[model samples]
Target: MYLAKRLSIQLLVLISVVTQQTTAQPLSNKRLEVSEKHLLTDLITEAISRDEWMDANQLFVSSLQAESIKSGELDNLKLSLGLANMPIDSLDFNQEAMTQLKFSVSQMLPRGDSLALKKETWQQKGQVALVQQYQRAAQIERDVSLTWLAIFEAKQSIALIEANRGLFEQLLEVSQASYSSALGRTSQGDIIKAELELIRLEDRLASLALIEQAKYAQLGHWLGDLESWPEPNSLPQVALKQARFYPADPVHFDDKSHLDNKGHLDEKTQTPNHSITDQTLSKQFVQHPNLIELDEKAQLAQVSMSLAKQAYQPQWGLNASYGYRDDAENGMPRSDFLSLGVTLDMPIFSKTAQDAGVKSKQLALNAIAFEQALALKQMLAKYRVIQSKVAKLNQRHHLYQSSLIPQLKQQEDIFLAAYKSNEGPFSDVIKARIESLNAKIQALVISVALQKQKVEFNYLFATSNDFLLGADLVAPMSSY
Candidate 1:
C-alpha cells in the first residue's frame, strides 16, 4: 500500500508540472522600443539633418576653395597691373587719387609714413581673413568629431551586448547539465522547467546579438572600417568639468521643453540650432571654434569696404626739400626747391566700379548678418528648448545611481545562490535572472543617455579652448 501511494504522488506531480510548463509560455528577453544606442548614432545621424552644419561645413570648404581662387586672381591682377613688381612702398605710378593722396600727406608727413599706414591696413585685413579661415576649419573638425563619437558609442553597445549574450550562453549550459543529473535530488519537474527557461533566455540573447552586426555595419558606414573600431574598454572617458547649465525660459520648461526634448532625442533635434543654442555673442566657441571665425568675416568685410572707397577721395600736400651732392666739399647743398600744391580728384562714378563696390560691401554685410541671425536664433529658440530637456535627464540621474543598481545587485545574489542549489522551483530562478538582465540593460540605457547629453552640452556651451581637442568645423580630408 505505501509503495503504490508514493508512485501515484510522483505521477500526479509530473503531470501538473508538464501542464504548467506548456501553459507558461517562454518569454524572450529582447529589449524593444528605443534606448541609448539609437541616440549614440543611428538616431542622431537622422536627427542632425544635413542642413546648416552641412551648409556651414560646405561654406567653410568653399571658402578655402574660393580663397585659393582669390589668391590666384590677386596674383594675376598684380601681374597685369605691374603692381606686384613694385614694392608696396614704391608708389611708382599713382592714379590721380593716389598721387593726390601722397602729395597732400607729404606736406604733413614723410613718404614712408604714408606708405606705412596703407600697408598696415592691407596686412591687417589679410591677417583677419587668415584667422577666420583657421577658425572655420577648426569648427568643421569638431562637428565631424562629435558625430563620430556617437558612432563609437553605438559600437560599444553592440560589443557589450554580445559579450553579455556569450556569458549567458555558457551559464545556461552549466545550469542545464547540473539540473539533469540532480533530477532525483532535485525535483524532475523543476529540472525540466529550468531547461525550458534556459532555452528561452538563449533565444532572447541570440535575437539581441543578431542586431549587433547591424550596429557594427552602421559603424563601418561612418568610419569606412570595422576592425578599426577602437576596443570598447580602451575608449577615453570624456569628462564634463564644469557645466554651466543652460538657463531656459521656465515658461517653456513647464510646458513645451518636456515635449520637445523629453521622451525621445529625435524630437529634440527639431528645436533647431537657432532654438536650442544659447549662442550669445558672449558665448565663446571652444569645441566648435568656428564661431570665432565669424568675427573675422565681419572684420574683413569692414576693411574691404574701406578699401573700395580708396579711389573716391582727394589728397593735397606741399613739400619743402633740399638735396646735397654726397661728394661735395663740406656737403654743400647742390639743389634746393620749395613746392606747394593742392590736388583734388573725384571719382568719375562708372557704374561698373560703383556697382562692384556696392556689391562687395553688400555681400560682406550679408554674410555677417546671416551668421549673426542664425546664431542668435539658435540660442533663443532651439538651444533653450534643448537645455530644458537636457535638465530633465539630469534630474533622473540620481534615481539610477542611488536606487536601481543596488536593488538589482541584491536580487542577483539571491537568485545566484538559489539556482546553484537546484532545490527551488526553476521558474523562480528564471524570474530572478530575467529581472536582473532587464535591470542591467536599463542601467546601460541611463548611462549612455547621460553621456550623450554631456557631449551635446559641451558642444553647445563649451568655449574656444575646449575645441582644441577636436575643433575642425570642416574636415580637411573631405576638402582634399
Candidate 2:
C-alpha cells in the first residue's frame, strides 16, 4: 500500500511539471522586449518599406507633381518666325514685289485664375496619394501582426499537446502493467483506450504542424524568405489604444426602467446614459486615413469644378510682330512693317459644353461626398462589432483564468488519484485529463484572439504618425 501511494505521488509530480511547462509562458505577464532584433515591429516596418505597391504609389505622387508643374506653365509666352514672298501683282495698285520675313511673339493669359486652380487640383491629388500610402502601411501592419499571432498560437498549441502526451504515455504504461499482472480492475479495454487516445494526440500534433506551416507561408507574403525565419516562441503584447470616441464608462440597457403611468416605458429613463452616437463615431472616423483619403479626393474634385467654371470666361491673347521686306522690283528699298494685336474668344457658342463640364464635375464631387458617408458608416459598424468581440473574449479569458482552468485541474488530479487506488474507472481518468488539456488550450486561444482584436482595433485610429514608427511618410523606404 505504501509503495502504491509513493507511485501515485510520483505520478502527480510528473503531471504537474508537464502542465507547468505547457501553461506557464502563455499565462505570464512578461512583455516581449522591443529592439532591432525583435520580430513584430521590425517585420512590420520591413514589410511597409519593401512593399512594391507603396513604391508605385510614391511614383504616382511624383507624376502628380509633374502635372502640377505642367499646369503652371500652360499660359507661357510663345514665339514664331515666318518667311514668304509678297504677291504684289494681284493687287490693283501694288507699290512693290518683295520677299518678306516675319518675327512674332504671342502670350496667352488664362481667364480668372484658371491656371492656379489647375495647379492646385494636381497638388491636391498628390496629397491624396500620400494619405493612401499611409493607410496601406497601417493595413500591412495589421496583417502582419495577425498572422504572427496565428503562428504563435499554433506553436503554443503544439507545445501543450506534446507536454500532455507524457501523461498519456504514463497512463498507458500503468494500464498495461496492471493488466499483465492480473491486478486491480485494469483490463485490456483500458489499455486499448489509452492507446487510442495516444494515437489521437499524435494526429492532433500532425494537424497543428500543418497549420503552423500554412501560417508561415502566409507570413512569408510580407516577410519574404521564410528559410531563415525563426519559429515564433514568444508572443508580443500589442498596446491597445483607446479609441477617441470610446466612452470611459459604457452604458447598458436597463430592462427594469420605471414605466410611465400609461404603462409605456419612460422615454427619458429608457435612454442609456453615456451612449455613443453616430455623430461621435463620424467625428472619430473622419480622422482615419481611409476617410481622410476620401476627403482629399473631394477637395480635389471641388478644385476641378472651380477650374471648369473658369472655362466660361473668355481667353485672351496678345501678339506683336515685325515684318521685313526686300527691295521692290523697281530697285527701291521698302520699309519694314510693325504690328500689334489683342485677341479674345467669346464663349457664346460654347455655353452648352462648358455647362456640361461644370455639371459633370459637380456630380463627381457630390459622389465623393456620398462615398465618404458610406465609408464612415461601414467603419463605425465594424468598430462596434470588433469592440463587442474584444469585450466578450476578455470576459471568457477571465473566467478561464479564475474559475474553469483551476477547477479542471483539480478534477484531473482527483480522477487520477482515484484511478490509481482502483476507486475510479480508467476511462474517467482519461476524460478528466482530456478536459483539462482542452481547457488550457482554450484559454490560450482566448488570449491570442484578444490580442489580435486589439491589434485590429488600434488600426482603426489612423493618424499621420500612427504606424509610421518615426519613418518619413513620403519616403518610407529611404531609411531602409
* Top candidate, metric lDDT: 2
After the best TM-score superposition of candidate 2, give how far the Cα of residue 358 lies from its true spot, in angstroms: 1.6
Q: Candidate 1 on 1-480: residue-level lDDT in tens?
A: 533543554454344323323322234233123243332332223222322444454455445545544433211111111122222565443321222211112332222233333444454454554454444433443354454444344445544544554555555556556657764234556555655554554444444434433444443333332232232332323344233434543323222333423233245443432432334423443233445456656665665566556545443344332221122235433332234544344456554786688678868768897996676556445345555555555434444455666666677667667666754544565566656666655655555565554555445444444222123332222110
Over 1-480, each residue of candidate 2 has an lDDT whose tens digit, in order, gives 533543554454344334323312243122234342365766677677777788788788889999999988766678999865655576422244445688999998888789899899889999999898878987887898898899789889989998998999898888888889987788888888887887777667666666766766666666554433444676667754443445352321112223344334346534333266768767776888899999999999999999999999898889999888777657777888899999997799989999999999999999999999899888877777775665456556667887888999999999889988989889888889899999999999988987787677767765655655322443232111
Segments of candidate 1 deviating more than 4 angstroms: 1-129, 132-167, 170-235, 241-288, 311-356, 379-386, 408-432, 461-480
CA-only RMSD, every prediction: 17.5, 9.3
Off by over 4 Å in 2: 1-39, 75-79, 84-99, 225-232, 243-281, 329-332, 467-480
Candidate 2 lDDT trough over 10 residues, lowest sum: 249-258
Q: What is the C-alpha lDDT of each candidate?
A: 0.44, 0.73
The TM-scores of all predictions, comma-separated, are 0.45, 0.79
Native-structure RMSD, model 2: 9.3
